[model samples]
Target: MNAQELRDKTPDQLRDELANLKKEAFNLRFQQATGQLENPARLRSVRRDAARVKTILNEQAAKAAE
Candidate 1:
């Protein structure tokens, strides 16, 4: 997903997306630990997606506070 897509989502939706991303990241890490991870790049993408969701949430919060 991209920033524009995330920006269009409600905060609650974004939170849900973040939670899913975190879960995926955790699973990716587990697979890596077990030497079963097929695509190592997926772990990095999931981490970045989670960060993007977080940044958007923070931006919304700051906007609301203003």
Candidate 2:
């Protein structure tokens, strides 16, 4: 998921996406701990995506407040 795509979504959608990303991140960590993670890159990607979503959410909230 890209920032542009995330920006196009509503706040509710963004929240949903963030939740899913966090869940995936947790699963990835579990796989790593279990020694079964196939793609290490995915863990990094999910973390970044979650951060991107958070940034966008903050930006939107700031806009709403102004």
What does the lDDT read for residue 10 in candidate 1?
A: 100
Q: Against the correct fold, how does model 1 do in TM-score?
A: 0.98
Per-residue lDDT, model 2, residue 31, is: 100
In candidate 2, what are the lDDT values of residues 1-66, reduced to their tens digit? 888999999999999999999999999999999999999999999999999999999999999999
Model 1 agreement with the true structure over 17-61: per-residue lDDT tens digits: 999999999999999999999999999999999999999999999
The parts of candidate 2 lying over 4 Å away from their true place are: none
lDDT of 2: 0.97
Instruction: Report lDDT per candidate.
Output: 0.97, 0.97
User: Which run of 10 residues does model 2 get worst, by summed lDDT?
Assistant: 1-10
